[model samples]
Target: MADRTITLLIVDDHPVVRDGLRGMFASAPGFEVLAEAADGREAVALATRLRPDVVLMDLRMPGGGGVEAITELGRLGLPSKVLVLTTYDTDSDTIPAIEAGATGYLLKDAPRDELFTAVRAAAEGRTVLSPAIASRLVSRVRSPHGGSLSAREREVIRLVARGTGNREIAAELFISEATVKTHLTHIYAKLGVKDRAAAVAAAYDRGILG
Candidate 1:
């Protein structure tokens, strides 16, 4: 028996960042840098080809963004786990990436040991979030308004506000019509509204829609 090596694909727009990560991982044991990509598109292509155990993804690349890439990977049914390693921890960045099927989210400033642990956890299909991001999510979930809407629920409500039907939302989000209905149900309960119209109005009033 032997310790398994965790394969990784590092995705970042900056070449210097990529080089640094490669070097850092190269110096560590029980890890292998399979390849590197400068943007999400390249990341997806390389992941498809290499089928690495985990992908160290960056959020705001020029050619393609991490959330879109994560969504595409899910749609394509790739088994690679995406661990977002980005500088941004705002709600806008964390929520979408998590909803898009990222296995973990970690800050770029994370210590080497913490990053390694997160990667190992992600490779094992565990969810990981940085302390700041986790606190933000906890506060959002514990908000006084029944409960704050999840990222998918927010997407559904936004579509509802625009008069998009369940079928259209399902198609757009790549979910089934039944899933869309379920999200709407949860959204209504969270917003303290019973119907689509009221839910949309509540979302607007509560500043969740903007």
Candidate 2:
């Protein structure tokens, strides 16, 4: 059987990064660069139109961030898979991207062969993570607290620690007040607390918030 070509949409804020990725994929067999987007919003629009096999997403951008775009794509029930290609591997970056429905996470420093392999795996609907990211995830899972706060939850808690109300947090995060409340509830449960104050305290104690 012939190998299938996997179509990709490359998204990054830097023009050079996009050019490099496009060039790299163009030189590789069994891959096609269908389009490129400079930020998350454009990435979503193009992905929605092209329905590519995979989306190479950057985590942070001015227009929109990768996690929000991933969430939107999942909500829209698009068939394309998202593979995060970013420099950040912190808990704040990794956990939320996975939660938002990324098929894989790879750092910019990944070897060319490794990136190609990860893109192929993502196209096959498999979960792929770099060695460092995999190790971090393993550590989180093995921690005594089975649940770790997602990036959004951490944001909400950080605001709560500063005495920010639900409405303000909703405004800041561009989410609904109800969503903010829901995140608070999840934070409380994850931190073994019963309310916002306790949740904030617990988060600080656990170094989830600075």
Candidate 3:
């Protein structure tokens, strides 16, 4: 059987960076560049239109940028897996971007091989974390602050991490969908996260989920 070909869309504000990435992926086997976007909104629009297997997204962009693009893509039920590329190595950027539905994070300085590998992995629904970012994820998961999340919140977080939607969670837990939403609202506030991916990331970070 032929190997599956992964379709990719590159989303970055810098022309030089975009060109460099396009060049790097040129020789990678079983991957195709589907489109390129100069900003987050364009990224979302293009990804939506192209329905590529993967998206290499930049974290910072002007006017409703990277994180928001990821958020919108998630809400719209787009199938593209997002891999964030950025210079910022801090937890704030990594965690939030992941929360925004990015499947992985790679630093801007990563070797071409590593970036390509990460992108391919994400296309297959796997999570990849750069070494520096992984450490922060470990530390955050081990933080004492997360102990404050309630039992119900923890349950909701578990289900969410398993990719269960609110309605399904409500059905499984024998609660109204509104109740599930309430739980998620509290979960978000307690975790200081804005979306499902972030909640899942935080849960894994804190050793609360497998």
Candidate 4:
């Protein structure tokens, strides 16, 4: 019959940012600031010990970035939902953090009310992505460059994006060197690239790899 309180662990490298967030949340209803952390590593430790319901995480920190922290939480099998609150919104930043298991993504310029709403949504295990970031993700998924590549071709492209050699990729995927070359050839054709370098760039630009 009573509303449950949502506990939060605020993670940011800046003390002032943490102070502002803490102050704001401390004044809000049905919310509690369980702890404050200056980096991703500290956030993970505090999240493990404090068992907060939600973590307001910053993506780029000095030690062990937010992506790494989010991943560690996933490995530890913690139930806390991570809400990314940071200034960065580029594809390079957003995609990895989301793929790393963040429950929500919001820009720092968000209004106070929207931020509160996002935190509550994240606490409920709901996916919250900023409008700009959401549009980019949707556009990336619907981009024309993706529809032509096969699953195997995409796998090879992903490896290539990571600078993996054909022989190494073949060994990792348990396939022969010739098969890897065939996949690369198809990837090149589908992505309209000439060589591995172009293919790698194309894959990332097309949102096939990030």
Candidate 5:
């Protein structure tokens, strides 16, 4: 390994997670954590100012979120590489993040050594993914019925799985029936199913609806 240290900016919504990561990295050699951000907006700001070699980013947050921050970093011409450190392994979560410019993806449950390796590799502009996430991506690629869906579309499908009709689903979600229909339409298109029943089955099969 090189003698130079790899600087990092840790971004996560949970203080406990940030603290854990900070302690873990602090205990390890050749890893310097410059700062921690509670949300993606703050991460983007600190990253722009600090320009750490790697950004350990959490996908879901109160603010703009990891993918948005990654996109913003690119738009601002920041050279920092982003490594997604999140719990989500779904296509809806992973695909947008990759498309938004994440250099790597690793689950929050990764072993300490693996996490360290991922960070170091990401700093060097290499791509990484946890085994589970890689499997999800591979399965998604192999199955044409598996595709990404927006939050609203997911909500619609969940209700469909619950055997709720469009009007009832709309009322439960505070959206109009037409809006629910539109969401179902989009969901069907994305999931490659022709109707609500098939959509629900595909979603459950793909782990979109639990």
Candidate 6:
């Protein structure tokens, strides 16, 4: 390992979850817990101020919540790599978190070793996902239409299905926000679904990509 430690910010609404994560990282070598936040808005604020190497964010929170927070961070050009830590494992959650500039996603119940690996990968700006989660997501996209959407469109759909906003999607895909919107417009037109939620549901039914 390098001499420098990996700095982290933990964001979750539940005190126990945040405390547990903090404690977990505290015991691990080459890791440092720089700060904590209880919701998405606070996460954005704390990340802007602390500028940690990585953020472990929860997906669901009220009031400009988790995914939106990621979007906000990208809008401000913060360098923190987001690693989503949430209980939700469905395509609905995984795709959006990634779309919202998350370097990876992990379940709340993941083993300590996996979490440690994931955090390190995230810190290095790599996308990480539990094997099972990855398999499910890939299958979800691949099962439908078997390749109906273009790669970029599929990327847009995957993130859209996961509930990510255009800004987050753009950051994750390394595209401009306007371009992301354009992709969505095409996706919506092709999928014949008016909104992201519907596009996600339709993708699953049709097997367009997953």
What lDDT does the true structure give each of the candidates?
0.88, 0.88, 0.81, 0.85, 0.85, 0.82
lDDT of 1 by residue, 1-210 (tens): 017999999999999999999999999998999999988889999999999999999988766778778988999999999999999887757887898899999999999999999999999999999999999999987776447887678888999999999988867764556668878888878888899999989999999988
lDDT of 5 at 201: 90
- Residues 1-99, model 2: lDDT tens digits: 018999999999999999999999999899999999987789999999999999999988766778788989999999999999999998878987898
> Model 6: per-residue lDDT, tens digit, 128-190?
997778898787666765335655688788887778888888667545577678777878888
Runs off by more than 4 Å, candidate 6? 145-210
Model 6's lDDT to the true fold?
0.82
User: By summed lDDT, which 10 consecutive residues of candidate 6 come out lowest?
Assistant: 143-152
Which portions of model 3 show Cα errors greater than 4 Å? Answer: 147-210
Candidate 5 per-residue C-alpha lDDT over 50-142 given as tens digits, one digit per residue, 9 for 90 to 100 = 999999999877645677788789899898999999998877678768877999999888999999999889888889999988888887768
Model 6 Cα shift for residue 92 (angstroms): 1.2
Worst lDDT 10-window in candidate 4: 143-152
Error of 1 at 188 (Å): 15
- Candidate 4, residues 19-120, lDDT tens digits: the string is 999999999998999999998789889999999999999977765578778988999999999999999887757876887799999999999999989988
Q: List the candidate 4 regions with Cα displacement exceeding 4 Å.
A: 145-210
**TM-score of each prediction:** 0.72, 0.81, 0.69, 0.71, 0.72, 0.70
After TM-score superposition, what is the CA distance of residue 52 in candidate 3 from its true location, in Å? 0.7
Clashes of each: 0, 0, 3, 0, 0, 11
Of 3 and 4, the candidate ranking higher by lDDT: 4
User: What residue runs in model 1 are displaced by over 4 Å at the alpha carbon?
Assistant: 144-210
Stretches of candidate 5 exceeding 4 Å from the true structure: 145-210
Better of 1 and 3 by TM-score: 1
